[model samples]
Target: MQAWGYVSHQIPLLSFASRLMNKLLAERDFSGQEICHVLLNCELQEGTRVVRAVDCRPYEQQGRSLRLQGDHDDDAEVVGIYEKYLSRPALHGELTYLDFLANWNTSKRDGRKWTRWSRQAKPRVLYYFPRYKSNPQHHQYDDFCRVKLMLAHPHRDPNELRKINGVEYDSYASAAEFCFANHQHPDDYYGTPNAEDRRPDPDEFEEEFHEPDLLDEDWLELARQLPDCPPSQEMVDLLGRRDIDIQYDWTPHVGRYADPGIVQGDYWRQRIAQNPLYMDVEDLPSEARDTLNAEQRIVYDTIVGHFQCESEEQILLHVDGGGGTGKSYLIKVLSSHLQKLARNRPSPIWRAAPTGVASNQIMGTTLHSLLRLPVDRAFTELSPADANALQNKLRDVRYLVIDEKSMLGLRQLSWIDKRLRQVFPARAVEFFGGISIILVGDFFQLPPIANKPLYFDGPLKDLHEASGQIAYRAFNYTVFLQKVQRQQGDDQASFRLALDELRGLKLSIESWKLLSQRVQAKLGQRDVDSFVLIRPMSHTLDPTLPHFKFLGKRSRKCSGAARESCGQWRAL
Candidate 1:
């Protein structure tokens, strides 16, 4: 194989024929040695280009017989021959070598035996010939091609030139034949006196090839046409300019705007018209004076004094109270008094709560809605229009009352303070925009979700210090509503004591036993009918229990009646 490597292409055609003869004999199960002539018919048109392979055959020279015989009138011409010694089988079986060869040839002609050489057509060849732009010698090829093609067809339109010259026919042969009359030399064509006159001027060519200048206005128009393209630099700068007063027409969002149903002017007007003399000091309602407990009276007096004070000092008050301490009743009295005082003018009192349900109970709105504060962003991050709107909203509001302060976080309180400061720059910087703000809630009620509470003195103090925000220090006055007005008598006294112990996280054995007594396991039908279950431990009662049906059905009916009857008994 090594020796044959040097002349591998020049190997004799008889070698390939001998190999084929041996393959054929092996395929036919032949074993003895035999000399045979093999002929391969290949059709070639021009020179060495093979058009197709026509046929193959093996002939026994001594016998003068063809192994694979067929009609000889075909147009395929014999191209070569291969003659060598090949193994042939002895004549023992019914099917001989001749019969096998005949069958194989028949299969090949019938299109069953397909060999690589027997393909009907050759594979297409892709030529990597030199294009005008790629050839270094043809640096000016594009210009030359365009000029020559145009001059050759002088009567053709501009559109026709683009269609035929650089784009349609990219070959140099096409350009030369069309323009130079088959002349191959580019330099000679350019040097010709007539061709020199036809050549385009360099200055004109540069001008024609240059791209158009795109101005800012042009780019803006283009951006408008193509929606996906971002705004250009010039447009962005114009929009970002502070001097441009871009008055945005903002729509009031549902949660951000106070409920129209509650804040309408007609509701306040009706209340004022119904009681024209309520604002007179002599006509003060007896309910305001009689209903308030001792602690609640102190809170009410502090709020009224703050409003009555004519000094520049702003008061920030927080009323610390637990559930059923008359905080809501106090708020109602303050609201009535403030509304009556400002009946001839705009209302000075603005009540807000953190939750919608609480806001509705106080006949006010959510704190976020009243101040137009964004739920997802901080007050400092408000847009110019939003900030201005907030300032206007806070301008006339003199008394701001925030209920349910437990659910509000330190950051939110700081945000409110910041917004107030922005609105009233003339007020003392220490207080909240010179407005008397009353915060009412128990810190232990419900902690703020995902943030630190107002009185949180945990490890997060450093975070508040870094932000330069004060939480508990903002309040100038604090009032405690310690009396439990809702509970009384021996049973109520015991219940209140147990609740206080639970709040302190110190559950006494007696308290646990008192709570456990309410959990009755089994009861008879008469007990179920007579049993008055006050407060169940769980929200869902055990439906499987025998007493559940009667208790569930009668408890709601009895509880309201029992509450009314219990209210009649007061502390001696």
Candidate 2:
């Protein structure tokens, strides 16, 4: 009987209803209160109802005749409530009528009404079952049951009042479907405290129980009190588990939060674990260092000087150049040189780009993936625990290289700034958590999608744009690489000139002609044949390709062998 509280939703209401009715009939001599008590304690599933379509008939054919003979005209009364009162917009008045009828049908009656029972038992049957009264759909199901019982003829067999708990056309004809339509998710009902059963809101709690906002300074002061030695096993276990409640008021730290010291120590421990030895710095290849031109060498030395400087002042650097001017190559060499200097202390340089393709060029991850930034909205502050976790992950990082800087919008830059500030709260006021930032890209390339460009001077839309503006203005050093490194030989001079004109958006007549001559339409038959065909649709490209004529003459039917060869080209 105790299991009644945890009754499976898989059990059909019809089965429970029929079982209750049988128990009631068996205890006919007992008082109403006694029958209620007995039924509440009895084993369920006894005398379970099994519905069959053959047992049911339309009301007009058999129910009307049976109702008139048995004087069960009151059956029409409950069915009228379902159709008429439920349809009215004034639900308060109609529900009052339903409650009165339900009570009237269950009570002892006078004159033509039977004292023991109503001639129509549909209302009485529905009134007896109140186990699922708290379920939101229970009232709707009751009305459905009433309408179905009144419209169906079951040959006076109470167990066969209807075929299912819902309309015949509905998918809720099965028990699983019925439960899904009625009950909430199992986790909502069983895993957490029910809404009605939970404690009052924090505002309602006594003043002493309220949790004050523990500021960063307050957290730091608490951390300074801890001993400067190895953490005890107890501290290690506490740091490892996520479920430990750090905010719980306890002795020796009743007013302050308990986790900040633990989180800070864990962060420092991770940084110290990556200790770089003197012998780890390998000598760079002389050719790699010697290959840099005068312009490239100057930029390299400027960045290296900032890295080796004893001061904590952040180096906000911008390395600007056009395509094929060795921007990517410069970044690679800079990252390599910096890594050698840091000697194996984790990765002192972190590289990221706005796109996967661009990131692949620099052997880095996408900015969004690297920073775990949200794409759909501007960045928001992270929870303390989450910020601490991110801090631990990037503890040894000192330099952040952002490639494809032109594609990075105001909002994304703000996200990076806000995230770094959270990760290193000690330097919250510093730009990018005091880590030197290097931005490298051609400014004329693709701009950020669906957001204002980083250099936009228009009125700021929100805090993110304002923050990005401030961060952008903080760049004190810039290195411009104007010398074209990739296209240097005489054979590429014309193409290089044309690209320069295109990048500047001032293409001349000669440059236009040079670009046009390389188009597919101007290519010779030999050049066309050398090119591979990639189109999936053979017919679409048949007239375009000069080699199509080799397969067959335009006016004639091509041979099967030739057509097969053409089809293979199309597949390629």
What are the runs in model 1 whose C-alpha is more than 4 Å off?
1-286, 381-385, 459-471, 520-572
Give the candidate number with the greatest TM-score.
2
lDDT string for model 2 (1-572, tens) is 11222443223433454567789988776566666768798533343321111112233332221222336645422233232222333323223222333333322222134222245432221222212222334454443343323322222222333334433433212332344456443211111111122333445435452322533445589999988998788887787354556555457656454556465778556555776222112345535856887667666665555555533667776777788899888777877787776764765778889999998888787888767799887567877787777787678778788999878888788889988888888898898988878888866776666665666666774778788877876775556677799999999998999988877667899999998887689999888889887433111212212312221332222111111122222100
- Give model 2's TM-score versus the native structure: 0.44
Model 2 C-alpha lDDT versus the unseen true structure:
0.57
Q: Pick the candidate with the highest lDDT.
A: 2
Give the lowest summed-lDDT range of ten residues in model 2.
186-195
Regions more than 4 Å wrong, model 2: 1-286, 525-572
